[model samples]
Target chain A: MSRVRICRVGESQFAAALLPREAAMPEGLSTRSGRRDAARFAVYRNNVGVGLTRALERRYPVTLRLVGEDFFRAMAREYVALAPPTSPVMLAYGSQFPEFVENFPPAAGIAYLADVARLEDAMASAFHAADEACLAMDALMAIPPDQLGDVRLTAHPAARLVSSPHPVGTIYARHGQDAVSPVTHWCAETVLVTRPHIRCEMQVLPVEEAGFAAALFSDEALGPAAEQAASRGGFDFGRALLRLVSAGAFSAAVNSAEKEARHA
Target chain B: MSIAFSKRGPRLGFFEVHAENYMGEGGLPHHQLRSIAERYPLSLHGVGLSIGGEGDLDRDHLKRLRRLVERYRPASFSEHLAWSTHESAFFNDLLPLPYTPETLERVARHVAEAQDILGVRMLLENPSTYLVFEESTIDEIDFLAAVSNRTGCGLLLDVNNVVVSSINHRLDPFAYVDRFPLDKVGEIHLAGYDEVTDEAGERLLIDAHASEILPDVFDLYRHTLRRFGPLPTLIEWDNDVPEFPLLFAEAERVTAALQEAWRLQPEAAARRSAA
Candidate 1:
């Protein structure tokens, strides 16, 4: 057979056998003694299973802590079997895992597990996101007070906002602890993850500012975003904008007038 | 790794990192690598290219690798002889392939294409396999030699893989080293392996880089150095990674062996320098 046909035939069987736990020994493989040793083939299977599971474990430490090691490993094995990585870059391998956890039956009882997974995924993404200079506080202050509302801000390349109906920020913050304090107040939370500098910083946005922050992230001009945020009472637009700017959320600020002039 | 290389750890010859891990556009990985690149030579080792896959290479992946090379301009680039992806699913492990003429041609084409796209001569490392293929018509050394000759690529003679594969196949490690095209070797890798038993109760070695380099592997490494002269060697301890001090100690052992090899084979050193 041609090499393509040979590899197609052999690798198809080999790939088929790797993911499934009870797959029979792939054909045409042998030990030095010419026997089709299941144990020998099992090594490859174990490498694939263990290697991928470890990758997930590295990415989702909080999830592992929540479920404990054994449970997490079993769950990760299922995730690996179902959604094997489609890309070679492992940094983005388990992007679909949070959704998978949401639909997983065993983890259904933990209502906040999926959200926590989402939070962790967002943190990983923010950590790996492209680096860019954040808009300096002085730069924001340099805008004339009259035209401040016309300024549009761009979200930093490394900024990620994850809003969840559960207090995922508290749960995520308790990572690496042996014993986590009970979260007495079950409430909605929004986490803004950003690699402002070398360290990845996660801050839980207050409920009132979540809408304003989301609007800004979606590239809304400050005037309109704050107006919509103001309709909902207690949304301090000044405080929220200052907080996000200090946290290095936005990268650049462009006035709507200047933007229009450039377009013209 | 950046911490070890940068902070109070022992200074070594060079540092290697998996290319896939740094595929991100920009982040701590790039930051750390840039700092390390400024201080020492960098070896960009890839584990995800699947150069030995039956299918055509992933162009997007090749593009990403090219971008990394252009950004870093690493001293050397190497990948395993095993395949890691099939169809679109990446297994993340270096899976074995049968050595056949047809496979040889496909691998050569892929290597050439990679070299053409990467704009650099690459090194192909030998794999430690647990199973053999019934369709394998060419010996492993000859297969690597042919690929090197066809593509003008260098070989990364991993001594740990030599011991693991030789013992797994019940072949002689010394003989395998003798057969290898030493002139084409640009770098060397020494890692530890885990031992297990096969179905027939025979010993099987898995190339698990979780522990210290074994005495047997070290012996094979010294033998290789004696034959091929001292080359740039890396101590790969990915899993159960110890403190920087311990990993550096492993490097120290390699250094000692390398010095001994240099002392023993002055003529080999001269030949290498002349070449």
Candidate 2:
């Protein structure tokens, strides 16, 4: 038989056997002595499992700390087996881990773990998102006051808003420490993640401003977004706009007249 | 290390990075890489191309690699001879393949395609294997030589991998080096291996790359340098990486070995002067 045909036949089996923790050794593999060595095959198995688990650990350090290392490792291994990375870019791996944690039975009790994972994922995304120039605060000031309402602001590529029912921002900030401070306020929180410069910055948005920020992110004009924020009662449109602009949430500000002129 | 390289850490030979790590659209990775490239030479080493897979190459991945190559124009570009992906699932580890004429044809075609797309010659690295396939008809070194000869691609002579695989397969490391195509070697890699016992009560070496190079691996590296002359050498410590100072110390050892190798071979010096 042609060795090529045999290789084509055995490679899929070889790949299938390496994934599952309880998989049997694929046939036709042997040591130099020609023995079907399970221990020898286990090296590849260990490499795949350990390599992916370490990748998850690096991505979700906060989640690892939330649950101690042992539990986290076990959870990571299970996740790896279930959803081994589809992409070779290890940095892009584990994008679906937050959802996996949410549906996981053992982790269901910790309602905040999934949100924490989500925050970390957003932070990572922002860190690696396209490098676009942030809209200077002066650009917004340069607009005529009357034309401001018709201005549509473009969200920065690196800007991400993560809203959770749990106090996830506080949990994420308390990471990398031995003791996590108790969250005195147990309510919903919205976080804005942006990399205006080299550092990734996160801020908790006031509950009233979440709607406004969401509207702005979705490309709503200033007038409507501010109106949406005002409908929430006691919403300060000027203060919210200034805060987001200063945070480098938007990349560009174009007035309706300029947009129409460009179209013409 | 990216930070250290950017901040002008101990100046050494060229710096290499995994191509996949910098495949993101834009970010700190690109920024840091740009800074490093401006200062020193960069090598684009890919770990996820899956060049030896039985299936067709990933076009999207090849495109991304092309974009990276176009942007950086690195001093060298290379990938492993082993495969890492099968179908849609990427194993994230360099999986082994059987060496046969059919597999050889597929790999050479893949390498030629990659070179066509990348618009640059690539060096293919030998892998450290624990088990051998029953269907493999070609020796590992011969398979590498055939691929290089067929595709016109260079080889990356990893001395530590020679030590690891030779011991695992019960072959002599020096003999394996003697048989390697030194003329095609564009680069060298030295790393540490983890030793374990196999089921048949034999010693198995795992290319863990988590610590310093072993004494025996260093000896083989010296032997390789004596035969092949000095080349651009890299010390890989991907996992359990120590501080920059310690990694630089390892690079210093490679430097010392390279200088000694250059002194020992007068023809190699003459060849360099003639070039």
Candidate 3:
């Protein structure tokens, strides 16, 4: 069987046919109606484009509503053309769309739009992320007070933190519920996306609390993480910790002893 | 199985989800699917496991599918007979395959491996194609039956796809359904499609699934039920999913058709049960 050559379709050649015909259509495509035509290529292109754009819209509905249908569709089309999905799963398809929007020339006027997209993408990703059991407060309490400084908490698999210079979360929240445009009050805002129970929940964080969460996300121990939060000033550690615990943000607590051993 | 749009869920015979959607590492996908599994029967219809490609089957995808099957224990698992991956790149569309002896051997081997890894039989679905391969040596129905017989897997007869393919290929839709090996079918699918014209002005049908089921498709589905019996049917609305009422209306329409089929042909329903 190995000796006899079997006829095979050239995959790369067929894939190139699906792309916009830069030069000419790849050879040997025929419909039952008759010969190959330019319009046949459009069928494949439309399938890929429309399918991906719908996926992007699903992931970033707030961005779509903010940009309006026409502009969002045009931008999504270009993004799809440039960065076609490597994976077949649509859940992870639009990760680059936020960055694409940030640099897209036409969208320069709407600076906060990029951040809004980032928030939406984070939420969608959080929705499909792997589930992990949240770390209980009792586990954190079990750690000795002196060794607490060395304890680093792991973020839950579904937890995502997005901080932006503009009030992106508020903008996204307003647009998400309806089509009303909110007044663009320029302020920094951070949002935490996590699946506390089965529902994916989004919460806005104050600047100081954002810093504390960022520190812990960067693997800072609880003691130093709290200190960093305190340095931000006006950050009530007990209050923020209670809110985070309630949100199911932390998945596992790494005690100082394990941290020390890993470092050692 | 209820895919709830309202505060409460709609009553469905079973819930079918695209397997690729739940492949993500443990978050809401798992949570919601786990909850749904506890309540209703699940059929994991996979879109990414390209079983007809020239290359070997993706071991990583198989591993993940195995995990999902082990975790959920879905009543049925299915994939398309079409290929999606080519040379290392995933196309995101079910590209058509040329049905020949070599392709048949390849697909049969792939299906067998998939069933072995998942520890259960899987169903292969017929895909809707816009073009025909000049190298093809067998008809679509024969190709599907051959693969099913070769590997101990079942068939998922997507009725909408049969209509679309028959129209595009200029074959009689009714004749295609008549020739289908209905006994091997474990589940059935009905979806919407879009109609376009080729350069030659010939009508071309694409399985878009973005709109309501057309009368032609509904009629074809009724024909399928009468022939194949009232199998576990799924109303697939992938793109532009309508409001809950409209979606449920489609399900109700299917129920109506099933009841009609039974009323008209009691003997066929008995045959379905015996099979």
Candidate 4:
């Protein structure tokens, strides 16, 4: 016999039983026909399960394709049961999905899948992230050359960097299309996501460039950021900076001395 | 699937989106919403507020909503009367609420807080449910009317939901509309529902919003308009989104209904005054 737990009119137990299979149906949950109707509860469960699964499928299309439909559905069911969305915004619902994939025992064989999910989640975030005015080249040039060393730059809100041990970006891009070309080799890769245009764009970056970008992202002074880039070896600081700037990644830059002097 | 609103096509009113979909920092969603807002009106229909939840409202979600409202300035803002969040968990479905005095007081308080924080009047939508609460002391119409009366919120009368809920509960759809506080209706919604038979082999209707509006739902909408007059109506097609032309075709059907309602208004008024 199934256990019967009587939940209050507006309580968590009633809501909890609707999502997870393990939760006993709240006593007194009845249809016009009968009390403790399991079939009516199934409809509610289906709504929560299918709705959340569809949301995850949309946010992680690449990951879904990689795992195959049945596998993805099964995995998503487990994820939804474990960690249902805390916010109403479906776009931001799967932030923990990448981490979930990392810990899922069934997905032990696919080491790169989690990183790819991370890349997709970041890309989705960038796609819906807030808009910011690009840092203009003229504005950067107008600053005193001598004071350039003290400038701290902030990347646009839509800009994101993801470094992974696997070539996740290429794998994400190729999985969905008509004809997916096999990757020649696998190696550590870093991806830069930005929405300089209307659509979000992603590009693979060399480790040195990624490291330099990460430094700049943390509000490092330009001089030290470049030095950090140089320490990474064989990176053209000017070329990497130009690429990021041209992509409209940096939104603002302030000279620390100038700001401090103004305050003083 | 994006389409430029054409002057030559069906009379498109405005777009309604789930506010949570566009809450990210900045990107394509913002870009698209910005451009669309420039040309047409918008409505920010929220699903995350959980106004009827037992727990207190989510402050972070409220802040995000306030920011979006400030940015988008949608013509109308609305949310369901049902609760989806409880404590830290947000169930994806719009869970039903019991119509008790205590529940009513809590929902009204939440709605007032949401409106005060958002600085905009919100419209609370009626929810379609699969089951009814035996502990309920008030009717659904009375409960919604009480909430709107207390919180100074408006009603988003979803016609399909009326049809769906009434059928599942074996109530009269038209009578529910008749008892509804139509004077408080700020906008209207028409959508499709899927029909299913429950375990007892009784017919149940699910508000799926996946296809064109059923004829019976359109009739319910017509009946609602006949009583309340034409408010700003919206066509909600959330799933299995058809092509723009097909969706627009369904919208044109609504346009036809509104026109028919307009044509019959004089007769309806005549009958009302005679009675």
Candidate 5:
């Protein structure tokens, strides 16, 4: 009979995810007692899984509402096992959840579930992103043209521009007592999330404008981004600019009045 | 922070809120907590201080904690006796520290420095731990008493934790109640625990705070009531929080018990006089 013990705190923390030392022990009284420890361990494991799932539910109430609570908890449990909290800091957790749902086997049946989660994760990221003031329309008009390319445009840290294959905009707009937005047509919609105030607001963007904003946010020059939008055929640059400004994405627009300083 | 819109201005209840979740802004959670802060006194209950570590307390965690206190102006502040970080690893659970002279000095200095910087007194809550380290020299109650005496800080007697720790270590919990330095006890915590069997075939309860208070714990709490009298007690049901009304009901139970204890005080004095 091999004597065994689960490593103590200094030896190995049960809270940590390491293989238990009791693996080699013979099954009997020790096993029964192990079951007891295992029962205690189950409480902790359940709390971590449920806590993270609830955090996800809070992030994507619309998604949870869409699937219903029973279905949502079941799916969330799967998502949590795959991606348990990597950081003690929860705001830093669940960045991959949107992507996780996209590839989850169970989520395949509900094609729109992943996109809804993506929208929710994007909103969570936007809310916790570094704080910066949005550039007023006047701030942009104040910029000179020469510095436009040289002055790299900086987007709000909280701003997230998402292009989805689902009509998340309409779904999200219908949010009420129901945890999920009403399922609607699967239009390839583009949405922009911005924190103009403490509350998060999402707006559906026209394809033409989304292209320009996405490119610019990725540090692409305006000329290329505009050219990319132009290549999209029937992309209206003038209307896109008006929409971008109206959405309050810009922090401060500086022109290359200096002709070379990159605006960050 | 939203001021209460009620004609009565605001309720005078005091409370504590966890600090880590609200460290960053632009979220609705922070906005709601700030609104609550507007109407009531708040305490920044810290989880990451790791004051009892062998190494110096994590400077970054302390600085972040400081920033939160500066912003919120909480009426009180507190942290646990156990450490959360060790050997550069940050364990989310409050792991126990060996009750020894070395740990006592480290934790005492940490508390005094925290008070000096925050310019306010802080309370230390004792931990409910499972395994006892062979490295310790002192008992938990005495270590806490020493820390309070050395640092001039107060104690946050978690009665449920005292009972849990006593059971795990095979000690009489009332002995803990009798030995505890009553003068330094500033506040109290009453919460639930889940019981499991140990390898010795004895029952071991974990402080999970999900279930209702066990009768044995309430009995021990009665001892605490006799020893410490009424302090601002909080019924924390972080896990499986039934509803707002349920939590209020639990608090009412503890408050009613405390009031009953006070109610008997004059009768006890009369009995002593007649004797």
Candidate 6:
């Protein structure tokens, strides 16, 4: 019964449930004339399903480009059936799709298909994320060095920290473009996509930098967050901080009472 | 096509944001809408608020929507004259509804309720459906007119959609011009649709808005202008978006149409001759 409800409008459930299965439906759920109602419902079901599938295809272009139209549409059809868009704004739909592609049977051949979706999802979120005035260095500098450890800085509203076991950014980049590149990692990648202006552009970062940003986003103070990143080998702590600051990755400077007095 | 706004600093167009995108757990979407609110007027276009639902209205959704309108002070607000309901479930597309009295009264009540809460008039756009219900008792033109008369809501005539619905249903598009209440129209939409053939070679015009406006759609807009007078017109090219220059050029086409209409308005022409 739950499964039938999940099929939505495009689903021809009543047509599927012909004479052999006539007696099973609960009252108010399916009718004796179920096929007629279901057929009429399918028109909208198909339309809604098609619209959402198209939105997903737009979001994950690289995945689509690599798989070709027929294969991708088939996958999109399945994905749509599984994760239908409940929201009317097409832009915000398909957040769960990347994870779905990872387990989808036909897509088993493409091991990193899920990660490609992750990058695309993050990019969409970043593109539509709110605009904020990034915190300034001068203000941060004013705080006493000792007090900096206690104050937690807020990450930029548009910045997203994504961590994956598979190299999603590399797959998205390679598949998203007209040309393919060998540099894409089969291993995991950590990425940051920030919409400083109108468009959100993706940048893959070293694990340490990604971890640092993620920590800051969780309200961890700068000093300890840098320490966590510093623990990652080959992490240039100073350069990483500079890159984040330049990108407007921090929205506001959080100050403890001591830190506030120091700045004063 | 030539169209123009009544007065201009930045013009009256708002970022026609989908209502669902901003339903956030307190995040950037709300923040951006607030920031943009300062520079430009916004239109809270409801895509998920199924106004035509048989079920009780989603109060949770309405509460969030009310909060946004209260905070933003948007210039205009709108939703579709369609049901996105699938049985008791909901879909993301603007699902069509039969124009019965029950549906009409329900939609009007919802529109009226929405306006009362938001403390402003609302615009309800007609949807483009691939199929029609046999149970439909009222014509769509009459249905819309009745809603306008009942709720005092404005009309957002999406001309491309009018053409799409007309061609898909094999009806006359210009007839919509006659039935649509011109006095109630507040805004106009001009968008592009894709022309494709189904597997059986049957013609289908989908309101995809992926590219440029078609010539026939432009003609419909001209008729709208002729009937309604020059209103706030927008050229939407959201998908497969070209450069800003191209969009600006499309806006110029609307500007031209409006300029022609302004010149043609009899009183204005007389004043211009006097000057």
- In terms of DockQ, which candidate is strongest? 2
Summarize candidate 3's per-residue lDDT along A101-148 as a digit string, tens digits. 999999999988999999888888888777678888888788777787
TM-scores for all candidates: the values are 0.96, 0.95, 0.88, 0.90, 0.74, 0.75
The CAPRI classification for model 1 reads as medium
lDDT by residue (B143-166, candidate 5, tens digit) is 998989998899998888988888
lDDT of 2 by residue, B12-113 (tens): 878999999998878889999998898789999999999999889999999999999999999999999999999889999999999989899999999999
Q: Candidate 6, residues A115-211: lDDT per residue as tens digits?
A: 7777778887777776677776777778888777676878887787778888877777766666787753467788777766566667788776888
lDDT by residue (B76-170, candidate 3, tens digit) is: 99999988877766668888878889899999999999999899999999999887776677988999999999998999988899889899888
| DockQ scores of the candidates | 0.66, 0.69, 0.44, 0.58, 0.20, 0.19
State the local distance difference test value for candidate 5: 0.70
| Ranking 1 against 5 by DockQ, winner | 1
Q: In candidate 5 chain A, what residue range of length 10 has the lowest lDDT sum?
A: A24-33
**What is model 1's DockQ versus the real complex?**
0.66
DockQ, candidate 6, comes to 0.19
- Alpha-carbon runs more than 4 Å astray in model 1: A1-9, A261-264, B1-9
For residues A52-71, write the lDDT of model 4, one tens digit per residue: 99999999999998989999
**Chain B only: TM-score of model 3:** 0.94
Ranking by lDDT: 1, 2, 4, 3, 6, 5
Q: What residue pairs are clashing in model 1?
A: none
Candidate 5 residue-wise lDDT at B124: 94
Alpha-carbon local distance difference test for all models: 0.91, 0.90, 0.83, 0.84, 0.70, 0.71
- Residues B100-203 of candidate 4: C-alpha lDDT, one tens digit per residue: 89999999999999999999999999999888776777888899999998989999999999999888888899999998885688789999999878878888
Task: Tell me the tens digit of each residue's lDDT in model 1 across B38-92.
Answer: 8889999999999999999999999999999999999999998989999989999
Rank candidates, TM-score, best first. Answer: 1, 2, 4, 3, 6, 5
Query: What are the runs in model 6 whose C-alpha is more than 4 Å off?
Result: A1-46, A147-151, A171-177, A184-188, A195-204, A207-247, A252-264, B1-45, B63-74, B85-90, B159-163, B166-171, B192-205, B210-224, B236-256, B263-275
Compute the DockQ of candidate 4.
0.58
In candidate 6, the second chain superimposes onto the true chain B with a TM-score of 0.86
Q: How far is candidate 5 from the true structure (C-alpha RMSD, Å)?
A: 6.4
State residue A233's C-alpha deviation in candidate 1, in Å.
3.4
- How displaced is residue A153 in candidate 2, in Å? 1.3
- Residue B61 shift from truth in candidate 5, angstroms: 1.4
